[model samples]
Every structure is written in C-alpha cells, then in structure tokens.
Target: MSLTKEQTQHLYHKLLDMKKELSGEKKETESMTEEVGELSNGVDNHMADHGTLVTDRMTDQTVREIDRELLEEVNHALQKMKDGTYGVCEKTGQDIPYERLKAVPYARMTVEAQADMEDELETDAPSFEREFHEQVKDLSNKETVDQKSSQTYEILDREQDSK
Candidate 1:
C-alpha cells in the first residue's frame, strides 16, 4: 500500500530530523579524524609517542568511516524524499512497508529484496568460523614444520659432536 499525505509528511519530517542528527555526528567524527594526525605521512610531529599516535589514528579512522557511511545513507534518503520517491523500494519500485521504514529509514530495498541480498552474501562469502579454522590449521602446520626443523638441527649437532 502507498503512504497517505499525512504519512508521507510524517516520514518526511522524520527523515529531516534523522538527517540533522547524522550531520552533526558526522562533523564531530570528522574533527576527531583530523585530530588523529598524519603520523604515517610525516605531516605531524608525533615523534614523542609514535605508537599511541598510530593507535589513535586507526581508531579515529574507523569512527570517521562509520560516520561517513551513515552520512551518505542519510543524504541519499533526503534526496529520495526530495525526488518524491521516499519510502519506496528502489529495487522493485514498490511502496516499502512502514515497519521496515521505521526500522531503517534509509533502506533502499524492500524486506524481501534485503533478505535475498543477505542470502546471497551468506552463500558468496566464507563464514568467519570457517576462515578461523583454516587459519588455525595453517598455524598448526607451521608448528609441525618448526618441530621437524628443530629435530633436524639437533641431529646435525649430534653428528658434529661424534666427529
């Protein structure tokens, strides 16, 4: 079902409110990212504590990245609202359910489309558990090689001693 005039107005206001909040948060994150400094690039004189600067830069970059992504979503939603296509699924051109919109106002697809995408992601990528187990196996193989190398070294040492 399509949204009524009242519902559309309501959602528009909600989107604006969310956009304002996200923009403010994005500004804060950007300032923090700037303060994180250019330790790697040698732009800032962080010679006193290079380690702490690197750690802080990594953490700030992560936060800034999150904020930038959210800001992009919020901006896209605002543009869709301006284009009179808000609350409509971009994939199927169907009116997205209000419940889903309420949960994620910036969503571009209907619940079914989103579920299909998630299923694809699950099938296309190796799970974290599987990757972790594979890494563990590799580490164990390295350990076994190390043990054999140590044994070979000991055997050579014994031969030299007997000579």
Candidate 2:
C-alpha cells in the first residue's frame, strides 16, 4: 500500500530535519590544518608525530566524503518526495513498509531488495576469508623458520661452551 498524506508529511519533516542537521555539520567541519593549528609546521616534531598528522588528515577527508555522500542521499530522498516516488522501492517498484520508512527515512529500496543487492555485491567481491587464511599460513611458516633458527643458534652456543 502507498503511504498516506499524513505519513508522507511526517517523513518529509524528518528528511528536512536530517538535511538541516547534516548541512550544519558539514559547515562546521574544519580542515585538518585548521584543526591542527601550528603543530603541523613544527620542525622539532618526531617522525611519528608527522605520520599521525597525515593519518588524521586522511581520516578527516574520509569522514567529510562520507558526510557529503549522506547529504547527497538526503537530497535525493527529498527530490523523490517531490517527484511523488517516496516510500517506493526504486529497485522493485513496490511500496516500502512504513515501519522501515520511519526507521530510515532516506531508504531507496525495500529491505529484501537491499539484502539481495548486497549479496550480489559480495559475490562479485574478492574472498576476504581466503586472503586472511593465506596471511595466517604465511605467518605460521615464518614462525616455524624463526624457531628453527633459534634452535640452531642454541646448539652452536652449546658446542662452543664444550670447546
């Protein structure tokens, strides 16, 4: 079933509120240089300190990008509302449940369709489990070699002591 007028209005307000909040947050975001102040210009700082600064800048950039993406999603949802397509799954052309809409006012697809899409993406992605197992196997082999080297060193020390 389609959403009632009152329900749509309620969701519209929710989306507007979310958009306002995200917009305000985006505006408040500061550049890493501004946030770090003169500390970034200090030549007396250690290499680790410089590395941390770089990492912090990268993290900040990532967060800003994520916020930008979410703001775009919120804008898209607002546009969909105007287009009279809100609360309908974009993928299946079916009515999205009101409860789901209430929980995630910006959702574009039904839960099932979203899950199916995620599964499809996962199928296309590389196997994380396989990569992890290979890393573990390599570490185990390195450990064994280190242990053997340590034993040989001990044996040589013992022979030197006897001499």
Candidate 3:
C-alpha cells in the first residue's frame, strides 16, 4: 500500500529527528584522549590500566562507527524523501509497510526482502568457507564414546587438558 501524505510526513520528521540525534551523539562521544584525563597515553600506568584504556578506546570507536553508519542511512532516507521515493522498498520496488517504516525510518527494503537478501548473502559465501562452517557444526554435534576412539575428540581433549 502506498503511504498516505500524513504517513510520509511522519516518516520524514522521524528521519530528520534520527539524523539530528545521531549527529549530535557522534559529536558528544568523548575521544580517547579526552576520556583519559591524563597528560599522556597511559604509558606511566599499570599494564592492565593501559589495556583497559585501549579496550575502552576500541569500544568508543565502534560506537562512533555505528552512529556514523546510522547517520548516513538517515541522510539517505532524507534524500529519498526529497526524491519522492520515501517508504518505497529499494530491493523489491514495493511500498514498504507503514509499521516497518515507523520502526526503522531509514529502512530501504521490506522485511521479507531484507530477509531474502540476507539469505542470499549466506548462500553466496565461498564454498570452502561454507564447507568449513558445516564441518565445524557437524563436529560439534558428534560425540565420541571415548576420546581415544575419535581423532577429533582426542585433539579437543588434548587442547582442553593443556588449557
């Protein structure tokens, strides 16, 4: 079903709000150096403290990346709105459901189309990688009565024993 004028306007405002929020959040996230509150990069601190700082920095970076991606999506949605194509599924050329649009204003595909695309991506994995994943799953499901009777079980036992 096509979006009503009110629905389109509602989604447009939602996208704008999301864009503003994401942009502000991206700026507000403290940088590693700012968060340190120290004169240097923790060189004079305990190794564990330094490690924690590194981990914190990595986490902050990941958050920023996510915010950046969301901001991009919001901008794309805004552009689509300007182009008179908001609420339309890019993949299937269908009018995206109002409920889904309400939930994810920047969504470019319908839920079913998105799931199908994800399934296609899974199937598009390299044959060797898929085979390796299947092998791992199969091994995980199999059991051996005795470690000595199964080479896989023996190796796993050895690794566990060493650990």
Candidate 4:
C-alpha cells in the first residue's frame, strides 16, 4: 500500500530535515578530517603526539565513511520519495506505519524485513575455522568411503578365487 498524501508530505518534510542535518554533519566531518590531515610531520612531532594524531585520524576516517554512507541512504530515500515509492517497505511492498516512518524517515524496509535481511547478512559470512574444519571432514569422509569400497572389492575377489 502507498502512503496517504498527508503522510507522504510529513515524511517528505522529515526526510528533508534529515538531509539538511546530515549535510551539516558531513561538512563538520570534512573539517575535522582537514584539520587532522596527513602524517607528513613524522620527524618533528613527539612519538606519543604522532600516535595520538594517527589515532584521531583513523577515528575521523571511520566517521567520515559512516557519514558518507548515511548521506547516500538519505539521498536514496529522497529519490524514492520523489519517485512516489516512499512509506512502502522496499522488501514487502506493504505500507510502513506512520510511527515507524516518523522514527526513521529513511527506512526502506519494515522492522521485520530489516531484521531478516540482517540475519541473512550475518549468516552469509562463514567463519574460517568452521569452513576449514568442514573441508577437512569432507576429505576424510571421502577417503574412508574409497577405502571401504576397495576393501569390499578385495573380499569379493578372494571369494571368487576360492570358488
């Protein structure tokens, strides 16, 4: 289901507000990063100072990346609103509640759908240890099957020879 005109307008305002806020945040992040710029003064700065600078730079980088991604989501949500697809769960094609939309104007999926997507994402990455163990177990099982087949064949040959 689609949103009512009033709901659409409300969400549109909410999204625009979010866009403005995110833009400001992105600008702030940019300034923070510019101030924390390169590690070129390695020789002049004390080791602890340099370490602190590097740590701050790393933290700012992560923040910048997160803000950038959020900006993209906000932009996408705005576009969806323009395209008349807002307030509908992207995964289920059902209307999202006004409360939910108010809480997260950029939400593309319903809570249940989002949870399911997260579950799928979490399960997609197999742990290296488990994968390695499974591969080793499979190889050993194949070898065991092959050895049993050979032993069975040898027993059959001995019976034929006795006959």
Candidate 5:
C-alpha cells in the first residue's frame, strides 16, 4: 500500500519530531553523566547527607535505557523513510492508519497485529497469581521497614521521657 504525497509528508514530519525529541533526550543524558561525574568528586556535606549517589546512578541508567530505545525507533523510522515503506505495517501488507503512524512512526505492526501479539504475550507469561504474590512480598518488606522505624521512634520518645 502506497501513501499519498501528503501522507508521506505527514509521516516524515512525525519522524522528524521523534528525531528532535530523541536528540534532546540524548543531550539530557549527557548532562546527567557530567553531573554524576562532578558529584563523584565533590565533598559537599549536603551530598553526603542526602545519599543520592545510588538514586543518581539509577536515574542515569534509566535515562540511558530510554535513550537507547528512542534511538532504535529513530533509526527504524529513518530506514522506513529511505525504503518508501514508512506507513506500511511489517506484519500485514496493509497501509497503517495515518493516525497510528503519526502517533508512533516506528510502529512495525498494524493495530490488529499489535493486539494479537499482545494477546500472545499475555498467554505466554506466568499467571497473575504468581505476579500478585511477588508484588505482595515486595510490599510486605516495605511495610516491615516502616514498622521498624515507627517502633524505634517510640522507644526513643520513651527514653527521652525517662531522662
């Protein structure tokens, strides 16, 4: 299925927007890395008190992961633009809806194909009970920490009263 000139232009514009967004994200990641480097050498008392090293490292990792995904999508869209298949679905020979392509220029599957793939993934994954139990276990650990902190605070208050 071939797109009209207008449709092609629309998809091209969408791809351009995605490229711009990814570039901005890449810059943000670079800035974050620089900040992390600066913090590593700093002796500021606030930095020591906040203990944000772990949080910064995790944030940098998350940003890098997102940047990688965005770069992949940008590359895929550029490839499709080169091949004149920008709006066509990889799974079906049909032309993907313009709205969908506008929303996700790198999408390889039509809506129906995407839905089918999601359904297949859902069936292949472990049962909800297993996932629920894992979540419950995580929440229980957090609750335990909260309880411990509260008890410690109560004991400290009682000691202050006695003093």
Candidate 6:
C-alpha cells in the first residue's frame, strides 16, 4: 500500500515543521557554544557561573545530537518520498500504518518491529552496553562461521552428507 495524496501532503507539512524546529535548535546550540567560549576566555567566574556554563554546554551537546539525528531521519524520509517508498517499514518492507506514520513521520521501523527492537535493546541493565555486546557477539558468530566455511573439504563433506 502507498500513501494517498492527502497523506503525502500531510507528511510533507510535518517534514517542514521538523525542519524548522531543527533549524531553530541548531541556531540555539551555536549561540550557546559561542557564549560558553567567550565566558571561558574571560576572567575567573564564580562557582555558580561555572556550574551554569557546564550545564549549558551539556544541554547544547544533547540538543545538537538530537538535531543531527532528526535531520538524518528527515532526510531519509524525504528520500523515501521521492522514491515512492515513504510509509514503508525499513525492516519488514511493509507499508507502515497511516496513523503510525502520522504520529512519527521520521519512523523507519513498523510499530511491532520497533517494539521488538526496543525490548531487545533494553533486556539488560545498561541498554546501550547490552546492544553493543549483542552486536559484538553477532560479529564473532559470523567470523566463526566464515572460518568453518574456509575449510572447503569439510564443507564438501557436509554437502555430500546432506545429499
């Protein structure tokens, strides 16, 4: 299934809104960084001033990261729209429900797939750590399989057995 003209227009508007928001955030981050740099170059500040500076810098970093990620997502969605593949799940290759897309215009995964992925990522105490470990484990498993496959005689023997 594909998005109708109305739906596409709605998504376009949403994309515009997101772009505006991201632009504003980028400006704010830049301004904050400039202020921080100027303050750092100035004479010794009070404890409160230093604390506020640290907090502002941290917030700026987080906002910039979020803006960057959102911009990438919006770009991907725009590309999909151009290719006539918008509203489709990247993982499942199925049309994502209209409501879901409306709610999250930058979504790349279907609801089910997103939930499953989230659950998998959150199964451990530290979700990011768990996700990293899982990725490493997958790479290791692939390497082991490739090593075994490099033994051509063993592979041929296995193939003959299967036949």
Cα RMSD of predicted structure 3: 10.5
Candidate 4 steric clashes: 0
Tens digits of per-residue lDDT, candidate 4, 11-72, equal 88877887787678343434444544544434575567657766676656755665667679
Question: Considering TM-score, which of the candidate structures 4 and 5 is the better prediction for this target?
Answer: 4
TM-score of each prediction? 0.57, 0.68, 0.68, 0.63, 0.59, 0.64
> Candidate 2: worst 10 consecutive residues by lDDT?
133-142
Model 6 lDDT per residue over 1-163, tens place = 6789999999988987887877663353456667667777878856787678777777567546656777889988988889888888888888898888898898898999998887876774495676455443433343544454434335456879999
Model 5 agreement with the true structure over 1-163: per-residue lDDT tens digits = 5667897787787777767776763443445557667766767647563357666666567556666676788788788889877777777778888778777778887899988976776677787654543333333343544453544345557879999
The residue pairs that clash in candidate 1, if any, are none
Alpha carbon deviation, residue 63, candidate 1 (Å): 1.9
Candidate 2, 1-163: lDDT as tens digits: 9999999999999999988987884445566667466565667767677578777676567556666777898999999999988889999999999999998899999999998987776677678754443333333343544453544345557879999
lDDT of 1 by residue, 1-163 (tens): 9778886777778777876775674334334346445445565565666666666666567556555676798789879888888888877888898888877778899999887876776677788754544433333343644453544345557879999
* lDDT, model 6: 0.74
Poorest stretch of ten by lDDT in candidate 6: 133-142
Model with the higher TM-score, candidate 1 or 4: 4
Q: Give the Å error, residue 45, model 4.
A: 5.5
Tell me which residue pairs clash in candidate 4. Answer: none
* Model 6 misplacement above 4 A: 28-45, 124-163
lDDT of each prediction vs. the true structure? 0.68, 0.76, 0.76, 0.70, 0.68, 0.74
Model 2 lDDT, full chain set: 0.76
